[model samples]
Target: MGCARWARRAAPARDIYLTYNWKWNVDEEICGICQQGFDQMCPKCVHPIECKPCVGECKHTFHVHCLDQWLLKRNICPMCRVNWVIFRKFE
Candidate 1:
């Protein structure tokens, strides 16, 4: 029936909206890198890329390129010096 088809379509739209809201909320609170609340930045680097959260526990979000370069020099977090290897294991 027409009603059944409309209901099916509406269900998916509602689900998509709910998912978007949840993702938005999570991204706002958690850092993409450290997976923790927003923290400080690396002193050596400047101009982070749009403030995306770090994907680790240090929760110290930073610019992608800045953190990438820093990691090349050291395997530990700049803030807490937590081993990158340990962080990877958790992921």
Candidate 2:
């Protein structure tokens, strides 16, 4: 009779490395245009604007549409006279 040999295989565990870059700015809870708290919908369109964009220079939050309307008349931030300078890192 011939003897049979069996071999066992083991799986190796892999380690994953992840890196992330996050940029966050503090935003007020109320929309200046609507005068409504973030928990409420935009007063103009009656839509949610949570996490809505804010003026980087002043940290003021506003509904996108609302800001658009305001921007039509002026190029500066509504709350601040600061020119709307889009942020970018020059190389």
Candidate 3:
């Protein structure tokens, strides 16, 4: 709807920068589906040491495992009800 803004500042490593930027727009620091912090291991994490987060086209974020489980039942995002596509993925 409007011009997209790109930050002029040099970015941190991608995973760090993207995750940190999301914090400002988020009301809660938890994944909408699993109710766990993005960096914490939710019950849904397939591997204990690696809980990647995925950002959808709607800009809502979720633990990848949680979102995968969700996508199995419905294609829309649990937070925004937008058609969920993996727009950006972070490790």
Candidate 4:
């Protein structure tokens, strides 16, 4: 066949490696309460999903678990010390 020669020279991939890098779209790179990166798993959380980034009305960012625990002690944001109001939780 006309294409046989080229096909025979093609090298087969013995191994494949893949990776990706992603970050939350927030102003803060680290959680105020936990002091951990928004991309990192919260210390109190067992799964990555539970450590999702959360934003407050004051525009501060925190890990979900970190914020949740901080809220239990006081009703104010850990960063700004403002009234803690959940603006949104990013999944």
Pick by TM-score: which candidate is best? 4
- The alpha-carbon lDDT assigned to residue 33 of candidate 4 equals 74
Local error of candidate 1 at 67, Å? 0.5
lDDT of 4 by residue, 1-91 (tens): 6697557665776887797777778898888777888777788877665679989889998888777788889999887898988898896
Tell me how candidate 1 scores on lDDT.
0.45
For all candidates, the clash counts are 11, 0, 0, 0
lDDT of 2: 0.57
For candidate 1, write residues 4-47 as lDDT tens digits: 76674344434333322112222234343443433333343342
lDDT of 3 by residue, 19-61 (tens): 2323323334788887888646679556434777788878788
Q: Which stretches of candidate 2 lie over 4 Å from their true place?
A: 1-26, 49-51, 86-91
Candidate number with greatest lDDT: 4
Models, CA RMSD each: 10.1, 9.0, 16.8, 3.0
Mark the regions of model 3 whose C-alpha exceeds 4 Å error after superposition.
Answer: 1-28, 46-49
Candidate 2, residue 21: how far the Cα is off, in Å: 27
Candidates' TM-scores? 0.36, 0.51, 0.63, 0.78
